[model samples]
Structures are given as C-alpha cells and as structure tokens.
Target: MRAAVYIRVSTDDQVKHGYSLAEQREACCSRARILGAQEVTVFSDEGISGSTLERPGLNEMREAAREGRFQLLVVRDPDRLSRKLAHQLLITDELEKCGIKLEFLDFDWKDTPEGRLFYSIRGAIAEYEREKIRDRMGRGKEQKARQGGIPINFDVFGYQYDPETGKVSYLEHEKKVVVEIFNWFTSEDIGANGIAKRLNENGIPTRRRAGRWHRQVVKQILANTVYIGLWRFKGMYIKVPPIIDENTFYRAQEKLKEVRRLYAGKQKHGYLLSGLITCADCGNTMTGAYARWWGKRERRYTCNKTCQGYKNEGCRPVKYILADALEEAVWNQIQTWLMDPDRLAREAMGQIVGQNDPREQIMVINKHLASIEKGQEALIDVIAKGYLDHMDSIEKKLAELKRRKEKLEKRKEELLLAYRQREELFAKIDEIREISESILRRLDDLAFTEKRSLVRALVKQVIVSGRGVPGGNGLRFINVTVLAKIPEQKISS
Candidate 1:
C-alpha cells in the first residue's frame, strides 16, 4: 500500500501548542508505517496556517493524490488538515473522489456519526481559538494606541522603533530624506513619479531595502500623515515627533489632489506636461488629448472642459497645442537655466531671504499657549473645588483652550521648520551649484523620465496657446514659468 503523510504547524501552534513541524511529521510517518504502507511520501507545510489551502506542500500533495500517487492520506488529526469544518470536509471529499482513504493517527472519527461530531467540535474549537487570539491581539493594539505607544511590530520609513520600550525615534538620515521628499513635491513642483525617478537615479534604497523606487511608494510617502507627527491607526491619531512640518505636509497633499484632478485618467499617454500645463485663454488645465488631423492621429494638449465637456462655458474657441514642441521648448529653457549656476544661486538665495520672519509670530503663539495652559489649570482647580454647577461649561472651555493651544503649537513648529529649512538651503547653495552644473553637462544624456523630472523641478508651469504642427518645431506661444525663485521666461516659436 502507498501512503502520503501531511503535516502543518503555524507559528503560534509551534510556540504555544508545542506542535512542532518535526514532531507532527514524525508522528504521521510513524502512523503511516504502522498502517503497513510500503512506499510512503511525507508532505509538510511549516509555519503555515491551516485556515487556507494555499500552502505549497498542501497543493503538491493534492496534485499527487489526484494522480493516484497514494492509496491513503494520513494526518495527526482532522484539524491538521484544516481548522475550518468546511475545509476539512472538502479536503476529505476530494481525497475520497481520488480513490484515497483518509486516516487520522490521533483519532478514528470520520466514519461514525458520533466520531464525525467530535471531529467537527474540535475543528470549531480550533477556529474559535484563532478568533479569540485575533480579538485579544486587536484589543492589545488598541490599548497601546490609546496610550500613545507604537503598537505594530513594523518599522516606518524614517523612524526607528524600540520594541522593548515601545518608543519611536527619528532616524536622522532617513528623516532628512523624508523632508527632502516633501520639499521636492511641494516646492520644486515634482510629482510622485518624478520623485521616484529621482530617488532611483540617486541610488537611494527604499525602506525595505528594495533596490528601486516605484511611483506608488513615493505616493504613499506623500500621503502618509505620519511624517507630520500624527500616526493614524484604526481611526485613532497618536502624536509623534514630526519629520516634515505640518504646513509642508498639507501643501504636498493639496498638490497631490491637484495632480489627481488634472491627470485623473490620462496616465496611459505618459504626457510630459499633463498636470503642469494650463490653457492661457480658458484659465483651465490643458489635458493630453488626441485629434484627427490631415487623416492622421495627432497627440496634442487641449482644454478638455472647453472642447469635450461644457463645464467651462466661458471658454470659447478651444485651444490645442502640439505636445512635442511645447515639451522641447520648455526643456531647452530649463537646460539653459541649469547651465548658468550664478543665476540659479542668485534666484534661489533671493527666494530663501524673501520668506517672512516667524519669530514674532512664534512669540505671540507662545504667549497664547501660556494663557491656555493657565486657563486649563484654573479649570482643573475649579473642578477639584467641587464647583459642579458650571462643570459642563468649564469642561467645554477647557477643551476649546486645548484645541487652540494645539493649533498654535502646530503653527509654531511650522514656522521653526521653515526657518531651519531656509538656513539649510543657504548653507547648501554651493552643493546645489555643483549638482546643477553636473545635470546641465549631462542634460542630453538623461532618459525621458529623468528629463521630465528635471523640467518639473525647475519649471512651475508651461502655458500653451494656439495650434501647431503635431511633430513639427513651430508653435504659436510657449511660456515657461520657472519656479518662483527664478525669473519667468516666455519663448515664442
């Protein structure tokens, strides 16, 4: 007789229930030999839960059983096959259909009604235990979150977690990268795809040590509020040390929303200036669209609201501009700017110095914060002194004060962060000069995506007007507005 022994042990089972994979394999093999089976095969799924049949070993065993490789299937118990009653019955029925008899070493229960009932009861108990374990773990996590502690055993990109102390701290190097990501997205006009490309070009590894960065990964980082000192878990927010200022984070979010609105369904064309271009006449975003011209399909940027939909009724005579000509015109201007390091430095420094000083504002915030703290203390004193008549009003006032204090503190942090970022930018002006020189020297050698990133970093908007040849060099108007720091240039072709 040919027999196949199957065993499985989840991680929890190995730790708490003492059900090691080796032990289960040994017991099943012993039972297979006792059944007088000559050619026995053993299939084991280690650290695999019995709730799912997706285990490699289990699938292989099922395939072999269907091929009539074994006359009997042996397991330590029915729950070893599956903790779910339905799965156990289905697996047994499958084996029976393959002309294989199912045998349990720990019990002989499948044939008789009482035995089947006992098997089902054990399976029910196993499933119930799993649910209870999950419930307990969820409760534990909720408790930890309520206490403002790191609950999950996972690491965030720019933060380090201490499992023993349940404390989280910023990883300085990674935090700098996080801040740079926000700065590029919000200030440099680089979208998530551009950021991901830049990270990959710079050989920056992801949080998981992945060799490449994807657009989705960059998007997740931009959308995560954790960098702003708020950890959202199961609808609860816990405060942490913020990596990026709240202002920058929210600004990035607004940019993301704008990008979504502009390039909502036009990703397939891979337009270079999809979200960055605006129709000069309509004052609406110009989207990438195709038109039939001279019996050929030509790709062009057009104001969709003016051309297709009636959303912008004020727009008359819809505008369509050649995609390639506008992209090239903008790219050429950006390359020219990159080649001039002195101009770049002057413009960047000017913007940095033009920022408003936040010290006075921060001082005022501190005064209000102090007042709020005193008010909270006074409210607590009143409550402690058995003044129950106006308890509700007192509590409401305290809550309002606390909310105001939080806002003021958040504003102060933003101001301080902005100041620090300016100082850092001033210090790194020389490094920026060198990097721009390198990029300018190798401008033509960069890939299309890399060129797109460079253009997005330097140019804020590429306003297009009038029609031009689809693949030709002539365009009616192309205005390349460089970033706020740099002087805007209008190129007419």
Candidate 2:
C-alpha cells in the first residue's frame, strides 16, 4: 500500500506551542509506516495558515491523490487539513471520490453515516475552539490599549519595538529618513508624485526594502499622525514619540488639500487649446483627444463626456473638430495680432478698460504677506527662547497662522500674475513691435509647450458652434464659427 503524509503549522503555532514542521512531519511519517504502508510520500506546508486552502503542499497532495500516487492520505489531525469545518469536509469528500483513504491520528474516520456525523461534529468543535482563541486575543489587545499599552504589532518603518519591555523607539537611520521625508514634502514646492520620483531616482529603499518608492507611500507618510506623536488606534489617537514637528506636519496636510483642489481638472498634457475651446451648445470645454486607426494617429478636439461613454443624456449628438485645422485657425489670428502690434495693444487695453488695475491688489497682498512673515518670525523667536510649558497650544496656534500665510502667499502669486499681464497690455508700441517681431520670427519653430503657453496667454475662450454635414466620401465635415478674443474692428480713419 502507498501512503501520503501531510503536515502543517503556522508561525504562531510554532512559537507558542513548539509545533515545528520537522516534528509534525516526523510524527506523521512514523504513524504512516505503522499503518502497513510499504511506500510513503511526504507533503508539508510550513508556517502557513490552515484557515486558507491555497497551500502549495495541499494542492500537490490533492493532485497526487487524483493521479493515484498514493492509496491513502494521512495527516496528524483534522485541524491540520483545515481549521474551517467546511474545508475539512470538502477535502475529505474529494479524497473519498478519488478512492484515497483519509486518516487522522487524533480523530476517527469512517465512510458510514453515523461516522460522518461524528467527524463533522469534531470539525465544528475545532473551528469553534479557534474562534474562541481569536476572540480572547482580540479582547486582550483592546484591554492592553485601554491600559495605555501599545496594541499594534509595532512593525512601523522608522521605529523599533522592544517586545520584552513593550516599548517603541526610533531607529536612528530610519528616524533620519522619516525626518527628511517630512522636510522635503513640506519645504519643496513639488507634490507627492514629484517626491516619489526623486526618491526612486535617488535609490531610496521603501519600508519593505524590496520595492521602489511610490506616490501613495510618500503621501501616507506625510498624512500619518504618528510622526507628530499621535498614533490613531481604532479611532483613538494615542501618544507616541514625535519625529516631525506639529508645524511641518500640519503644513504638509494643508498642502495636500491645496494640491488636490488646485490641480483637479487641470490638463497636464501640452494641448494647445485644451482649456480655451468651449462647445457653445453644451457649454462643455473641448479638450484635446487622439485615436489610433489603421496604424495612423488622428488628433482632434472633442467634448469628452459626450464622446467618451460618460453617457450625457442631454448631449444627444457629439461634435469634434480636427486639431490641426482649429489650431491653425487660432494660430493665424495670433500671428495677425503679432504683425500689427499697435492694434493688438489697443484690443488688449479695450478688454481691460473697466477692470481696476491689479497693482493695488498686489500691494495689499504684499502687506499681508509681510505681516504673516513677521508673525512667523516672532513664533520662531519665542521657541528659540525656550518657552516650553505650553508648547502644544503654541504649536497649534503657529500651525493655524502658517495655514493662513500659505493662503495669502498663493493669492499674492495670482495677483502678481495679473499685474504682469496688465503690464504687458500697457507695453509701448515700439517695445511691442520689437518683442512681437522677435516672437514672430520663431513662430513656425515653436515647440508644442511654447505654443500652448502662447495660446493660454492670449486666447481667453474659443466658442465653437457648428453642425456636422455628411460628405461624399462617407465622412463627416464639421464647420464651426469661431468667436475670437479680439474681434475684427475697423481702425479709426
């Protein structure tokens, strides 16, 4: 008779009960030899959970039994096959169909109805015992947490855990890494994606030390309250040792929100008229799109939701304009304005005639920025002077002030941009002519990025209104009306 012996144990079982894989294997093989088997094959799954049926050894054993590699399958216990009663019954039934005898050292096995009922009860009791043990462990951890002990596994990246003392402290090198991550995120203008790219380029190892850094990982580090000594456990934030200051941590959080808000719906691709073109009918912006057909690429501007399966019920029909044609039309207008600088300047001035000069707003923003800077300096000065008792309240106040300062700084940049554009509108005819001619010289050779910048600077909104007409070649021809930013005006005689 041929016999197969299977053994299994989990990491916790090995450590807590000294149930080593070698010990199980030795015991199972010995028991199989005593059961009148001349041939024996060993299949063992080490340090794997019996809760899951996806073990490699278990799969191989099942396949072997089907192939008649062994006449009997032996395991030390029913729980060794599975801790779940359903899984135990499933494996036994499959083995019976395969004509392979199933035997366990700790439980009796029989094919009779009464024997099957006893087997099921034994499996159920095993599962219930496992569940009871899980419940006890969970309650133990919760009680530990309530008593101000660390309830987590304590394998956090930058910290080292002392199992004997139940204490956690920073590993020096990893602690430095944590500080650098926070510093780079808060101080640099780059977002989490840019930081992740830099980290990967610098060959920085991730927490697992096997994978490269990712944007989400970097973001998680920034948003983790642990760096600021607040470790959240089941909605309760417990105190931990601080690595990043509250000021820097809160600033990074604010920056995360600002980045998401400001960069949402922004097209990063260099589409010349991306945010400039609008469908007059649907009021939706027509963005740049491309398709590959028959080994050739076609680029066009399209109302995305209407054509892209978003199923906009109101937009019954869709409209698309060739990228090349619309870009050429808009570029030609830009060139015409460039050749006649005085008329361009006049149109620019006319557009802003009623709007107030942005310089006054710029001045006010600068004053507020300066006041915030002064406040920041004062807080630093107080910290430098060793005022330590109320540091928590002081840090919170400083973080709030910094958040306000960031808002003001962002507004100042906007105002400054407007001020620069207003300055361009007021350029002298001679300067405009010189600059325009110089730009027009390289107009044809401009890169896509440069052309995009030029379009965004000059064109405010391009409204497209047209209907499609079927052409003779089984194609559609789209004719659209363009409402230019600078309408053609007859010069004063």
Best-performing candidate as measured by lDDT: 1
lDDT of every model, 2 decimals: 0.78, 0.76
Task: Tell me the tens digit of each residue's lDDT in model 1 across 1-493.
Answer: 8999998888888787799878887888888889899988999898888889798999999989866789888898887888887898788878876668888877775567786788778777878887998899999999989998878974789999889987789988888889888989888967787888788778887887755677788889999988989989999998888888888888998998999987766555567776788766667887777776568777777775522112464345555676766677777777767778777778667766655667767788889989989999999998899998997899789868855875687689898988787777776777667878888777779977887777676668776655444344747444434332245666776
lDDT score for residue 220 of model 1: 90
Candidate 1 residue 135 Cα shift, in angstroms, is 2.0
TM-score of 1: 0.53
| TM-score of each predicted structure versus truth | 0.53, 0.53
The weakest ten consecutive residues by lDDT in model 1 span: 306-315
Lowest lDDT block of 10, candidate 2: 306-315
RMSD of each: 29.1, 32.3
For all candidates, what are the clash counts?
Answer: 0, 0
After superposition, the stretches of candidate 2 with alpha carbons farther than 4 Å from their true spots are 15-27, 30-34, 201-203, 265-493
